[model samples]
Target: MNKPKYGPPHHSASPRYTGLRTYMKLPNVNDPHELNDADIAIVGLPFDTAASYRSGARFGPAGIREISMLLRPANAFHKINPFDYCSVIDFGDLPLIPGHIHDSYDVMKEAYRQFAKHNVVPIGLGGDHSVTLGELRGLAEVYGPLSLVHFDAHGDTWDNYWGKKYTHGTPFRRAAEEQIIDPNSSIQIGLRGTVYSPDDMDAAKEMGFQILTAEEARELAPKQLSEAIRSRVGNKPVFLTFDIDFFDPAYAPGTGTPEPGGFTSVEGLSFVRHLPLVNYVGFDLVEVLPALDQSEITAQLGAAIVYEFITIMALKNRDGKT
Candidate 1:
């Protein structure tokens, strides 16, 4: 068990957490960017009109924000207070056009475009993996070709999923095909399970993404894992896309898609922490369906990922200029 510092426990009878609202209030995404102001915009995109199985991922952004409010001020591994170095704003959810897939993407794309213009780093709570497409579109529009450090159980490299295109399963493929992302510099980690076709796996390789299976990761020491991640990401702008289903179902039972025998929550964090700062750029935490969970373990784990990203930002900001 993790030992607490000084504040009242999370389950204490005190008034701090027993209220109707539990999360801390940060600035809204609509706030204008000042000349020297730097902020992390935490936006939620609840559009999940294309989910094939579970549909509650539309509720993920709110659930993650609620948990963030419940989190204490101290960082677990880094021991750094987030308020010391930067500011975070809860930009609320992106508006989605109802009943239209492409229209929904356009709405999210515009929101990202506005955030990018302000030089704000977006830490999004996703509706589905498809939100990555819109977010990447904005980033690529500004920064040109980038690399990816994708943590998930599926390759997400299918050309087309189901009868139509633009599902969560095809975003990376679309991005790579458009040359917005350099697959040669990208890394897809923790791939396991039979979620898609064999051809999809080949597409990831053919498109130039380096795929690291869970079994291979486990076989190597922690140092090797970090080295492999660094080698794949190289010296390009990196986008960190974390899918909750990347963890085993036992650790994350509240996701829309639960692949058994996947990496545990601890393993996922280890993978994230190993990614070096030279290539790091942005991140997203996606696909936590609170409707399926009452214990809130998945939500708490999602909060952990946000914390990891915060530490990365602190380190990056400290070193990037000097």
Candidate 2:
């Protein structure tokens, strides 16, 4: 077998905990020109100012990286070594301004726009769920409006928070308003918990999003859920955003606004694994606050989910779908 062009060094050759932390210990390449040969770029967007509840998710990127060293290169369930199929790198954290959302959004959008120009798929380790809006802005410039596959315990479609339009709870609504994501082709899963009004979930439906509440999701098997998601988002450029809080607070307590009655780690992973291979442009996993994390279990699970995202891309590449 031919050796992989880029990947983490074997654990036997280099100790896991010995170096500057990067996702899976992959090489760090910050220059966009250098991305020409890379297939995937794992980036950290460490801006949590938009978080309305507990802060400190600004450190989420570092937390995920610190624990990501434990991940291996191969994906057993997908039956393909991801690194063998594609060259992936840790692009390091994107720049962000503390307590400044609009400026940070501009910076983040431009950075992602550059990556999109290079055709390198970015997997963002997020600062908060709101960071996804910047990612979508950049990517939509290149891919047009994208289909959204959102997993979270909250609808996150509120028009505004305290008269502010750009909080973590309102990115999707803004994404819809800005025409960055095509709501007609989008689907939100795992929405549960009390809301300000009954119209909260209904509002998303009114905007053309297909939502499956946490209760509704529990009724369907993982395969069944994936089928429902595929049927809703048929043949569109997809951008998947997962809030760590999509799982129960018992499993992912490190998030800012975690709710109960969610999926288990196995169940969450299974749902992602069964996702129908479509035109995927980008992905992000958000809301991991290490300070609240118990034993970094949430971070570890976040890393594993990102790994699954890479595995999916590798599978797509192997099948000549990209």
Candidate 3:
């Protein structure tokens, strides 16, 4: 087979700890020419000022990358090495302002728009859930309205927080309003936690999102759960967003919001693994706060989940589905 244009160096060439700490040690590039060669690009979205409960998710991108070096090319379950079929790169982080959500959103939208122009599928390491709203704006410019598959402990559909229309807990509602994501074809899984009112839950459903509370998710087998996602999403261009807090606090404690009744990491992986074929346009994993993570377990789980996404991309290429 011909060599892939871009990939992480083999372990024999250099130690994992010796690199500049780009995700999986892939070449970190910013030039348009270099960016053009990649099929999948790992980019960071490091702005978390919109978070309501806790801060420091701004460091989530760095925290996930710092531990991602431990990831290997081969996925044991997929029985294939992703790098063999796709060119991957670390494109570094999109530009952001520290405390400005709307300004950061503009910059992120333009940056991600460039990725879409180049036909690159961005797997983002996020600063907060609000980052997805910007990403959707950018990608929707290229791909119209997208179907959403959201996994989180919260619905994130609140209309406002503290008189503000945009916050970490309110991106999905904003996205639906902007018509960047079509809620009719969307599904939000693993929503479990206390809310301000019953209207909070009703809001997401009224907007046409198929809601699966954490308890409801636990009732279905992994395959059944995945099938439900596929059935709802169908063949639409789907963008997936995963909040690290979707897992139980015992499994992922370093998050802005912690909920007690959530699934285990193992179960989360099973759901991703069994996800059926669909037109996946992009993915993001958010809300990993390393300052709150004493053991880096949350970061570890975050990296693992992103790796599964990479595997899915590779499997698509291998099967000629891309």
Candidate 4:
């Protein structure tokens, strides 16, 4: 038998429904040596053990990949083709330990470390928000103390959840405590909904993260929010994390935690489009629960967001910005 070809299958040669389903039909390169020359690597982190609500996010990576088959090479909004500007490939998924958050985090971090070694910017499809701690640990090893730009309906900055220190709701707090991210330069946008305590926001504020409530974000123009983000990050190596719950439940209902009054899909894309100038080191889109997705809307939106992240990289490459 012949070895399968890597990268996206040609639409003319093969239908979108056929072939191995890599992200956006990109090449699959699992060997670090093969990935050394790649500009962007797409990987799946399919572990959701720490989720406080739904547990189906463990299937998020495959969900996103399945819908991403519809993505074409060109991004009409950005007016650039990501594959044309960068060598993007799928690095497959990391080997995560089931039912063990700490061990899974370690595996995630080690995988990212390998990507960082070759200057490959990783665009991760996440398991849960807790997986971000591992991503930060890995990226920070390459670029010390990264500036974070987090988009989510909740802060995920609570000190702890139910006496456990490593739940999805507590990753950012752990990141802040461990200095995986530069708290002063970090920002969390789209935070809203009821909380366990009024001090929930206070705790995140105390950690030095600039919090922008979903209401405030809705009030600001996309340009204004973009300026706020660029101002806060200020030339630092940045890690951008987007939780699917950042979108209004109407737009993305497949997340573990859904909150009202969040950004619409158009608004979310507009916000992301304005972020090409940020010094992004890595990016991830997490907490996409396919079980709750209505008509695959959430998964499609998640795939579009990942596509936009690639467009950002393409824009940067085109302008020589990053």
CA lDDT of each candidate? 0.73, 0.91, 0.90, 0.88
lDDT of 2 at 292: 97
Worst 10 residues of 3 by lDDT: 29-38
Off by over 4 Å in 2: 1-4
Across residues 229-267, which tens digit of lDDT does each residue of candidate 3 receive? 889988889999999999999999999999998989889
lDDT of 4 by residue, 1-322 (tens): 1222334556687777777788977888888888666888898999988999888898999999999988776788777766667778899899897799888888888888888888889999988899999999998898889999999999998878789999999999999889989889999999999999988898888889999999889898888999999999999999999999999999999989999888899999899887748788899999999988998889999999998988888778778885
Checking candidate 2 for backbone clashes, the offending pairs are none
Once fitted onto the true fold, the runs of candidate 1 whose alpha carbons sit more than 4 angstroms away are: 1-24, 32-36, 320-322
Error of 3 at 98 (Å): 1.0
Which digits, one per residue and each the tens of the lDDT, describe model 1 over residues 1-322? 1221112234344544454332344545354444125456677878776665787888887787677667665667666665556555666677875457788878766766666677667787877788888888877777788788888887778878666778887889989988889999888877888755667677689889998876766686656777887777777777889988888889989887788888777777876766576655568988888899658888878878877787677666655631
Q: Give candidate 1's whole-model lDDT.
A: 0.73
lDDT (0-100) at residue 165 of candidate 2? 93
Q: Which one wins by lDDT: 2 or 4?
A: 2
The lDDT leader among the candidates is: 2
Clashes (backbone N, CA, C under 3 Å), per candidate, total 1, 0, 0, 3
Indicate whether candidate 1 or candidate 3 has the larger TM-score.
3
- Model 4 segments more than 4 A misplaced: 1-7
Error of 3 at 294 (Å): 2.3
lDDT, model 1, position 145: 81
Q: What C-alpha RMSD separates each model from the true structure? A: 4.9, 1.2, 1.1, 3.2
